[model samples]
Target chain A: MTPLDFVVSLALISVAAGVLGSLVGLGGGVVIVPVLTIFYGVNIRLAIGASIVSVIATSSGAAAAYVRERMTNLRAGMFLEVATTTGALSGAYLATLLPERFLFAFFGVVLAYSSVITYRKRHEDQLLAVSNDRIANYFNLHGSYYDEAEGREITYKVSGTKLGLVLMYIAGLVSALLGIGSGALKVPAMDGAMHLPMKVSTATSNFMIGVTAAASAGVYFIRGQIDPIIAAPVAAGVLLGATFGARVLGRITSRTIRLLFVGVLVVISLEMLQKGLFP
Target chain B: MMTRQSPGPDPQKNVTPEGDLQVSGRHRNLSPAQVAAMEEKIRKIEFAISLVLRVGVILSVSVIAIGLGVMFYHHGDYTSITGHASYKTLTSRSTPFPHSLGQLRRSLVHGDGRGIVVLGVFLLILTPILRVAVGVVSFFYEKDVPMALVTLFVLVVLIASFFLAGL
Candidate 1:
């Protein structure tokens, strides 16, 4: 396709991905990249470049609303950024050493595995944990929220600092090697291990992604992988999508939507394996 | 805290259902302070809603602007505009009109779309994984750590994905 055609198509994809990502809080760039590269025949490097822009665009955009609602734990995110960024830096460095085939194979496997787990936990039965932590205490991570359903104030804490940091390290590695946000990793670590509530995890993860991306995006940039042409639109589109998604988050059943999204990932992972093996 | 619940008719539809329009049917003995406190609570919720609205608007605008900017630059090619030390210069091989932009023209060139595909795929897997973190952060902010911790379990598969897929 002509560059114009490519960009126009990309815009359409961005909106769709944004809607999907925001609706599910999964950010479009992650899904958009695979679709562009594996299905549409776009180059992965170009996809990453575009996804970077999209990442910034979506997170920043969505973050605005999240912050206003007091849902986004900006401080927690910024503080933990220390660990996540460090992990991402190391991952980025490691990515250069791994063979392309290995990287591709590895990413494909992660997608497959996550999809299965998502399928298993696609319900409202989920709960949260309220615990103590030096990091959370020092950062004043404990806070209260107005639960709209209960029409009452529900306060919580920033538990599992050490565990969260460990997950962040892994998250950083994946992000660096794959150009994906470590939020997936970070959210679970904080929420499950530390017993944080879901909203805090989601918002905190959103707040932290930029730093994680920054850590590795720079590495990728230096590796001559960040093509502005690609990065600009994807990033812009993702940003838009993310912002829109955040605004509408309250309007939809993100949990259910996310579950369905996991199903889609399974197919994607399988396709990647098939192609990788066959081609 | 989001005081602005969905615009549904169920529970949080209106902030003040009876502003000074008190019902006299019940004993007409309710204290003014009680009524005033309820109204005050609603007002606080309204303020929270307003704050959320403000943030939402900015978020949407930025997303669109940034997405389009990236696309436009990508369409035009950032090499010509950013002028960063690393941008690849556009040559006849990479650009049809190598000399059309005069001084703003890109002088270096080389790109691999496969790299983009790799990046995209990597990012695709990342969204869900990273989203979990955001969910946790949101929980903490909302003082809903209970839910946050439960959702954290979702990361098990994400972690599995990392090791199994090598991401």
Candidate 2:
């Protein structure tokens, strides 16, 4: 194919990835990596570089709208970021020491378990009316948003602040080690552990992933793994798609969002399992 | 969904209006006016952060799009570029791209497509870091000192990651 054809086709595929990614709070890396390597025959390193670019693209693109809409729990996100960033710093070191297959298999099981939990809670939006978590209270992590689908303002309390921080650290570590954004882990940490409303968890997760990814992006850039031609179309396409997804998110019900997230979680778990068992 | 009532005989009922400013486990008792004021403050912070993110994405994507155009104009087709032996070596994993700021500057001066695209990617990577910096400033503006410190710590760690990568 001509260069233009490759660019256009890759861009189109990335748009789809971006849409699904932003909607579910997973970055486009999950789709971009395999597609680039398997279909386009791009080098694995370059594909990862492109995936990194797309992760940031999807996050920043979608998060801009989520924050503006007040769907994102910004304080919770920022606070959790403290843990994620630190986890990433250590994960970078651990990446060289740990066995990849074992880590993948372990994380896969964790995701599968979380997916089940998420599925069971799909119909129920867990917006706690009161939380006694002192850490969350002191940090002012509680939030409220106008749910377009429910057509009412939903105010919620945040709980499990300590647990949320622990999970976020693991999420950051996994993403750094695996070279994927790992928003799947982040969503569950907020939704299940912290009792954030489904939309708030998704939006807040979306807001935080960019910062986590950016922490490693500089390294990838310096290493020259980021191929310009491969990343250009992917970044631009994902940005467009994520922007569109962010707009659609507010209109959708929390139940629908939870269901979609559960589906993605199952698929990601399966993929992780395959990589672990097969590799 | 069942709306659960606050579990106690509401201490907030007799509390003075100044109680609204005190940190609490639940914000359920804030009067509508206080809620509005709080929401306004939060909105301003969100707006600032959102604006930063939106601007960053737009700027980076525009540069990348322009870079793609330049690439196509220069090379015409992927096949022709690959036909050259140098192209093979250039695309290999072992050989890194012009990634540093100085190299980027030189390449842009010459209007190199790949260099321009890398610059865009660089900008894209910087966006989230910029957003975190904005977060620190926003928290400071709100007089949320502890949260500001937390954000600053994250920012410090992020900058530290770059140096760690070098090691």
Candidate 3:
């Protein structure tokens, strides 16, 4: 294909990825990487570099709307960012020390388990009446949002602050090592452990992924892995798509979001398992 | 923080048919006017954050689009360009690109497409960090000292990651 053709096709595909990523609270790297490498015959390193750019684009683009709508838990996101950023820094160091296959397999199993749990909880109501967790109370992690689908305001208390932080750290580590956003983990942590509403969890995860990806982006840039020609179209396309996706998210029911997320998780988990078991 | 009861029925039910807006947080105990004022302040902070993100994305995408146009203009008839061995080398992992601020500046001076695109990406990367900085300011403005400190710590860790990665 011609360079123009290549760029156009990649951008189109990236737009789709961004839509799904934003809706499901993923970074879209899962889609970006495989397509770039398998279909475009791009180098793995360059594909990963492009994925990093796409993740940030998705995060910032969708977050602009999510934050404005008050769907995102800003305090929770910022507080957990401490763990994620520090974990990313450590993950960069651990990259050379640990076995890649083992890490992938471990995380894969974890994702598979979480996906099942998420599927089982798909019908459960998200808002809890009250929470007695002192750490959560002190941090004031509780939040409320106007549910467009339900046509009412939803208030919920947060719990398991410590578990949520630990999970975020792992999510960050996975993101840095795998060159993915790891929003899969972030959503589950917030939704399940932290007792946040599903939409809030997704929005908060979307809000935080950009910063997590930014932590490692500089390194990728300096290493000459980030090709501008490849990344430019991807970034622009994803940003546009994410903006549209953010608009749709508020209108949809939480059940649909969880189901979609579970589907993505299952696919990603299987992919990780394949890589680990085969490699 | 006192939890003030709403004048009407309980608001914590899973389904509130009345659609009464109940905000639960530090402001849950405040009077209706106080709650409205606090919500307004929070909305302003969120608006500021969103504005930063929106502006940053638009600016970066515009630069990237311009750079793409320049590239297409420079290398007319992209089919021929793709057929050449140079294209393969250019797309390869070993392709030489600007990897530092100084190199990026020099390339931009020469009107290089790649440099311009990378600059856009750099701006894209900076947007989230800028948002975090804005978060600290917003939290501080709200007189939420602990939250502000937490956000500052996150900012420090993000900056520290850059140095750690450099090492």
Candidate 2: C-alpha RMSD after superposition = 4.9
lDDT of 3 by residue, B1-167 (tens): 00111111122331234654433333333567766676566666667777788899999999999888887778776635355423345677666788877789999998988888998999999999999999888777666677789889989988887776562
> Model 3, stretches more than 4 Å misplaced?
B1-40, B79-89
State the displacement of the C-alpha of residue A253, model 1, in Å, after optimal TM-score superposition. Answer: 4.1
Model number 1 iRMSD: 14.2
- The pairs that clash in candidate 2 are none
Q: What value does the TM-score of chain B take for model 1?
A: 0.34
Q: Candidate 1 lDDT, tens digit per residue, B35-54?
A: 45544554554454445434
* Predicted structure 1: lDDT: 0.52
| Model 3 chain B worst lDDT window (10 residues) | B1-10
lDDT of 2 at A49: 81
The CAPRI class of candidate 2 is acceptable
- Tell me the docking grade of candidate 3: acceptable
TM-scores, all models, native as reference = 0.60, 0.88, 0.90
> Model 3: what is its DockQ?
0.40
- Candidate 2 lDDT over A8-57, as tens digits, reads 78899999999888988888887898888778777877887888888899
Q: Tens digit of lDDT per residue, candidate 2, span B37-130?
A: 6556666666676677788888998888888778767865453423433333444666555776678889899998888898888888889899
Alpha carbon deviation, residue B116, candidate 2 (Å): 0.5
lDDT of 1 at A230: 50
